[model samples]
Target: MQINKRHQVSPYLVFFIIYNSQVGVGILGFQRTIAAKAGYDAWIGVIIAGSFVQVFIWMMYKLLAKADGDIVDVHSKMLGNLLGSVPSFVIMIYYWLASVSVILSFIEIIQVWMFPTLPSWILCSLILGLVYYCVSGGFRVVVGVSFLSFIIPQLLFIVLYLYPLKSAHFSNLLPILNHSYKELFDAVKSSMYTIAGTETLLMFYPFIREVKSSKKFAHLGVLFTTILYTISAIISFTFYSESQLKETIWPELSLTKVIRLSY
Candidate 1:
């Protein structure tokens, strides 16, 4: 089914969409998990996991091009409607669970930091309502939100890095290849969950205005987030030692506490 031109977004917007999807609440604390086994060398695992995502993006484009529609269409083409809908339903459930996980994470952060007495269900309901409103406006509204999300926090993060940099022990990252292959691979596996949102393309492929030209933008978005995660991991590694990082739950968020700005 062809999407209306009005509902379609520009190819370049794919960068922001992909970036926003991948960089969720996970980034705040992924450092601890990735570094658990691989030690400081886990930043390398981030790059490795990103390379896998790049390849996955390439294959998705090829398949979607052939199907000429979203994942549901691909399913219908390959399998009969009845049979295909089964797996499609499962995929939809998976996305729902993923979204819920992210939402719960956001609610947890809010409750822990800003509203200690706030009930989880209230925050969850409010967030779901807001999401429903935006989604009802169609994909374009979501794309606009994605773009702003990519731009605004970026500036704040740039400033946030300065505070942590002053205390970072660069020596923490020395002996880059000291970890064994097993440890490195363990890090890669853990990092995969943090960088796993690119599969969202399967649902929105048909919503892209220039589907063919959009591949580069999609991959560029992945590359950008990959670099972002890599840099984030490296910074967290250098800022906190092996034992300290293990104890600190949200390393990135904790980095913000040290930021000081005079009026």
Candidate 2:
């Protein structure tokens, strides 16, 4: 876990990696997925899930502090070489799965919205090439890309969502407590994947330049993600009826269809 000088990034960059890592393809369909269970109260589920994310951030920092390294080190020390290597290998596989999931989701979006005829292998190859380039340059380059990716799309997509509100039926969000506690719990679980990738922090925390001070920014990063998720849920609930939302696959993307441009 001896990070070289060139590989370390400022603590503030931690915000970008954590925030962007959690805000991927999961958000694209999360509204409908959560709404199906919690009805109009799903926004509350989003908030609850976000609260769990904040707790997770704290837990990870605590673990990293104790280990003075990443999760790999924790497992190695807590269990012993052979036993610990099992979980470490599993984590590596899990990371590969997560990467594939996000890439496929984006490729699906491209096929549906931009290039209906594009082949999946072509897209995968292109995306993996870019991934190889980013990974080869090392962590700092990846962090820079992540920061820009989160900020730029967030600005434009937030604007896209705003116009949908012009025709939104706020009454759609009424009877907010209609769901039972069990149903709300289901919704919260459903929204959890939107915050799933933050766990990767355990692998990257050792690279923060001011590792101790960076805890503050890491919490801020989680807070920022929670606020974004909460806002998106609120807008989506207000914009669509409960039944309508449940039937739609990607309501956030569908909302953009309502946007109009002036000449």
Top candidate by lDDT: 1
Q: Write the per-residue lDDT of candidate 2 for residues 1-263, one digit (tens) a residue.
A: 78887899999888899888888888878988888788878888888988898898999989988988899999998998889999999999999899988999999999998999999999999999999999899999999899889879978877877898898788887866987999999989998977788888989988889888888888888888888888888888888877788787888888888888899
Backbone clashes counted, model 1:
0
What would the per-residue lDDT of candidate 1 be over residues 1-263, giving only the tens digit for each residue? 69999999999999999999899999999999999979999999999999999999999999999999999999999997989998899999999999989998999899987999999999999999999999999999999999999999899889978789999899999988999999999999999999999999999999999898899999999999999999999999999999999999899999988888899
For all candidates in order, the CA lDDT equals 0.94, 0.87
User: What pairs collide in candidate 1?
Assistant: none
- For model 2, state the Cα shift of residue 146 in Å: 1.0
